[model samples]
Target chain A: MHSDLVASVRRFNRTVTQRVGALDDEYMARGRPLAQARLLWEIGPDGAEVAAVRARLGLDSGYLSRLLRNLENDGLVTVGPDDQLGGDGRVRVAALTESGRAEWTELDKRSDELAWSILEPLTAQRRQRLTSAMAEVERLLVASMVVIEPCSPNDPRARACLRAYARDVARRFDDGFDPALSTPVRDEQLIPPAGVFLLATLNSEPVGCGAVKLHPGTPAEIKRVWVADTVRGLGVGRRMLGELEEYAAERGWTAIRLDTNRNLTEAIAMYRSAGYREIERYNTEHYAHHWFEKRLRPPRTSGSRGHSDN
Target chain B: MHSDLVASVRRFNRTVTQRVGALDDEYMARGRPLAQARLLWEIGPDGAEVAAVRARLGLDSGYLSRLLRNLENDGLVTVGPDDQLGGDGRVRVAALTESGRAEWTELDKRSDELAWSILEPLTAQRRQRLTSAMAEVERLLVASMVVIEPCSPNDPRARACLRAYARDVARRFDDGFDPALSTPVRDEQLIPPAGVFLLATLNSEPVGCGAVKLHPGTPAEIKRVWVADTVRGLGVGRRMLGELEEYAAERGWTAIRLDTNRNLTEAIAMYRSAGYREIERYNTEHYAHHWFEKRLRPPRTSGSRGHSDN
Candidate 1:
């Protein structure tokens, strides 16, 4: 890694942390500290189930319970069994009280004010540029956190991601997509020795998938690459493609190919830019209008087993 | 002021802080905390005066001394009087010992690894996009923190910024620029009630300046508009322009004009994009080529005052 890039990222972290008051024990002068304020905001107006809150914030269950007790003592919230949202009768949910509602409004107002304080001094054009750049940075940062790992094709999460991918293509394609009518590479084929499946996840939620099939004497094939719309611009698709290529190269394969529908313009552009060349159709799949191929180099090996996995 | 834009920035702050481990007491696995590690990095290879570290980090004198003492006790550094760097005989400077150099190298290496960990999972193209976006975000964030304040034309920092501007123009102009030869808006002219001079500063260091000379019956003229090259692409020029216009509007003038040499192509483009129109030459100044003007809007009113000045 280039040292300058590290310095730039560190500088960005320092500047942004200071600007956002992350270093402050008390945030936005709300009387309570940032973690508590954040808890209040997360609980929100309608409130949330104890499990949901714990999972969303990735907090220790005991720590989250303590925070809830603090808020309850403050008369800012009430925690009890909730059946209205259709959870089990014994499951407890936390909700804002009337006073808590007012407090939440105040917290939100102060949060907005804090945000605006960073932008108000800037000219209109600078504010626009800064916000858009921030959006881009946020997208990429989220992308960086997404984990792409080899998984069983039949893993529940992997299958769910494929289902989401299928649903998306069905809605987008003119004739409507049907896996039953398309080329089949079932569980047996996606398992190791035949091929491998890769799952992309964010915060433990599966969001994307891709598969590669090895050919003993012929070029390997790539298929089923997809990314959740929530992470579309984050470059997840390209990352999965690279991972699939690495999977193939590790198995001693030097080439891979894939087919796609013409309506999938962005995917086509991504493949072209990723060094895939347009080639003659090698299959009669009813959906595929364009076929592409790319040759791969040997996978890189490090002298030391550095961190190459999440 | 846009609510969505504010929300975007806040979300970005949350994501980036978490990703960079700013919330962690232990940073990049360094044994010492972030403050001490940062002090080591700031003290750097050549060593630095204690005062420079305090000023650069904005740490209180007592707090800085305490941190230095901690490092001193760890046998990683030595802080003592140094006269070779030209400070007073009793002035203290901090330098790394042999073990401190080894420790600094360890910290540097880990920092690089942490940065690479963010990029290593990304494909090459995605890493490129991320780093470049970070660069853009860093520039805009710095630009956002810059404060523009009304200052006496003869204020030492303001004069220093002006001298730097003159030196820059002299190097760039075909015939070379001379403050003596150009039309001068003397100190008296820039004093309030006649006009105002604004200084642009980042962390208390003046980086740019502009002055407006109010005209009783004619459009006010913007003069000496300049930004340090270090901050050029961060939209500081446009900000300074907007600020000068605001200064004029507060005094009841609504139109502003300025002239520049053709060699300053970027300045010309910025003027055009900022709604300045190319009118006939407004002066016979030695380096003047194109003259531009713009009409200003009424100053925005908010019940709450904003931090537009340092």
Candidate 2:
């Protein structure tokens, strides 16, 4: 990273963190901390699974359980039964007390005030700058935080993100997406020594991903490269592609290939813009007519992630 | 509205709602209902005034109060603190509870899940469509919700929005904005019975605004027309201009004139596109070297708050 740009980014982060009070001991509110308030909100009026909450929040399971225990002790949340949360019929489902809901409402008001208040000091000109800056920060953070990892096809969030990507392709492609026509990413194929998939995250939210396979005799195929629209310009897609390429290169694959439809103008633009040369019908895969090939450069001896737009 | 289109929107809403379970009565992760959950998210962790909350949410005061009351009772929030809301100290405050922050986190997770779920069932093309539709809806709804009203020159939000516009214009404009040189919108000009101002909104957030004032000797004067960058290209600037023209015509002003710097390309494009002819300079306004004017048809007998975009 360029030092000046990195410094600017760091400054921006500091400014935003201060403005949003991100580093406050408790993220809740003036009266109550955010952790406790979040628990109350999650408990809701009925109940929620501890593990689900943990997964959703990306909180450590033990930390989440302790939080739940605290809420339960306060009588703001009640521990009860849930079929899905635990294997056995009896599971500790946490539900908010009536008072808990009211507490949440108050916090909701406070939080809005805080967000608006940040917008307050700035003249409309400043507000615009702030909004623009926030937008930029969101994009940059999401783009930078992407991590590509190989996982089984059944991984819930991975499957969810890919499905989302597929739906996106369907809407964009002239003929739409057909899962049947595309080769399904098999669970066995995604394992290390075989292949790997990568997931991108920002602020702990999954925003993008990509995958590459270790073919027995052919070039590794790159598939399912995607970036959430919210973070598109932040270069997540390019990064994902780069990661996939690196993974393939590590496995001795010299070239990577992929296919897309005409309707995907942006993706096509992204790929072409990223030095993916058009190939003449490399794959007869039913859904793929437009194929692209990228010859991977050898892994950097210095082990630094290569910085290239393509 | 087209029935099919309306049906499609409704279906979209229902399907999204059902799939996301945004309004699930019993997800019970938080005490607040779906609406409250959304409101909390909007509010963030800061705080908001009663009136602003009402305006943004488009809710009745009584209902808003009751919601606040519920939250307050549950120790999620407190209202009516100090007058820190605006420079004016009469506004009511709403703050969050300890549990409220926790609940907000839960709501945030749910929202992400919902966003994911909506994109999950579609092909990639469909996902693109959904994103496009969302962008359109955001634009159109914002455009439609804007209100053209007579405002005092010093209204803070209006002023803030205008200042924002000025700063943007200055930066984009070659000469840049010199507050000393720029023609300041005078109070007498914007205050009705002389002219009117319009503010654009989206879900109650003030996105943009414009003003028209009837100068006694000269053709009607257009001043203080500014749109937030967040809402640029949404046709708001055009609508505001048209409405100002109608306001001018209603006041028996034959031609409307405005002055702008040469560097403001978008504004110039808008002026040209809207049929305003550049002619010999009209006024001695310190900042304006190029002045433009447009002739307008007579106004309607009864004012229905409309302008001639045609």
Candidate 3:
């Protein structure tokens, strides 16, 4: 919100874009647009499902199809039905041709060179400092890029996050977690009116999720707050917590609570740091080791109720 | 350099480039490549010398000319010799036409929108965190991007740094600095065989300078160790100090010394932190209030003497 911050971001955008040669038409001098080059790289030697490439690149179907056509016309790629899994005719795959593989290799080498070019001018010490700072910036930028919004609990991305969350807890818990042994949460309970499921995504791929159950007459209960290892410690979990809390507060819940296993030490620390206090066990979930609660203030009059379409 | 650091930087490059839409042919959907839009933005409504724009963008003459020609062809800009300063026919300027100004305004608006788009998804608190991280990344990246290499003191860029250094000290010295009353460093003394002058540049523009004079027997004396205000606190001064020391050490000098005005507190602090020790007055320069000396380590056998063509 600060103008100075906005101005700083604009300056950063300019400097970074230029440094990375993002403005170049022929990326890495490969004689093709960057988008096409990136697509070729994404398809790779082993090839990729058309839908998978589209998802990873966040490219719309039409634009991606056009780029694929361009590469196909150049004799650098071939699009055909994926035959690896019994040839699902509706599911197409994009594979690099011999020339495309060569081009991809060249792009790979050039990418390393570009990275080195940025470091080469700097002294070894400055290079270290630059990279360290770069890592910090990348982590935080990723944190900012993550979008947390309401979603159907049964949506594929939401389901993916839930499966990841369960798998993660299974690995970390003292007694490995079992969904059958633990209290179950139905999709209907997480849908709007009764409650909501919040999905966190980066570039359209789900990385984290949290949900709240707005039980009648009782305080709203938070559940399944989880962040993927890839985005952990960048405060994705904290942001999810804040969003969940905001959601409950806006809908008139005065407090929220969640239970966690003792093995999830970092989650406990995060909860405490986020103003959630140690509380008596509020539920008899089989894996619960610690329970925490945070009182939420009533949403301001200016704050709108219902979901944010982030 | 750590491989992890390099890997992290590479990842940052990929993520940031995609987020900024740097790969788009039509930046901000303006129907022009990003390079052209950036050049148009650089030229501004008032116009700029063709040479200045090239320098700022670090674009080669051929590439810059082509971009200018494209804008010229589009009827958005005009390239002609300057007439306002008594018409130097050889000195060309690029000015926006009426339509070009309108396009510039649109580009400016889109730039703001682009900046906002990165922020709009987040809570205000996260926005603050993101912008703060961006500023840090920008500062460190700028520091890393700076290339310090030996240059002739008489070169225009070096001269510019010297002028800026003098102007800066003049404003800071308690009694004000007067070059006439101080020890004069001849250009030849700082141009090798005698010594070396190191110029620090961000992109192609000079931002800082340091020079060392290898006297016949005494310690090599450092002079005009200055960093522009824009890059002062990002460790440019420290890097310059290290480079100057390395230059002297590689050529058989075992120690270095410099005189400084007390009012230049940050420089004094940097020198102290960089292992410089207070010493007895070594010279009678009029405005100097502190004298410092640093013993230099011998350059390793693997280290080459003379200069690095950075």
* lDDT, candidate 1, B88-194, per-residue tens: 98779999988888887877676666777777777666667777888777777787788889999889999898889889899989988877888877788888777
Extract clashing residue pairs from model 3: none
lDDT of 1 at B116: 77
lDDT tens digits, residues B128-168, model 3?
Answer: 77787777677777777888999989899998998888888
Off by over 4 Å in 2: A22-34, A41-47, A56-63, A83-91, A162-186, A201-207, A227-233, A306-310, B1-310
Clashes of each: 0, 67, 0
The iRMS of the candidates, in order, is 2.7, 14.3, 3.4
lDDT of every model, 2 decimals: 0.82, 0.64, 0.83
What is the lDDT for B139 in model 2? 36
Model 1 quality (TM-score): 0.75
Query: What's the CA error at residue B278 for candidate 2, in Å?
Result: 32
Ranking by DockQ: 1, 3, 2
Predicted candidate 2 versus true structure: per-residue lDDT over B1-310, tens digit per residue:
2333333333332232222232232342455565565456545668777787777666788887887887777776777656553555767777666777777677655544434433333334434444444443333433334555655667787777777877777787666778777556666667886677766664445677778876566678788788887767656787778878877887777788898877677888899889999988766776666789999777767764534322
Winner by TM-score between candidate 3 and candidate 1: 1
Candidate 3 Cα outliers beyond 4 Å, as residue runs: A21-51, A58-132, A149-154, A165-198, A209-229, A232-310, B21-27, B58-83, B92-106, B123-125, B173-175, B214-219, B252-298, B302-310
* Alpha-carbon deviation at B273 in model 3, angstroms: 4.8
Q: TM-scores of the first chain across all predictions?
A: 0.86, 0.79, 0.91
Local error of candidate 2 at residue B50 (angstroms): 43
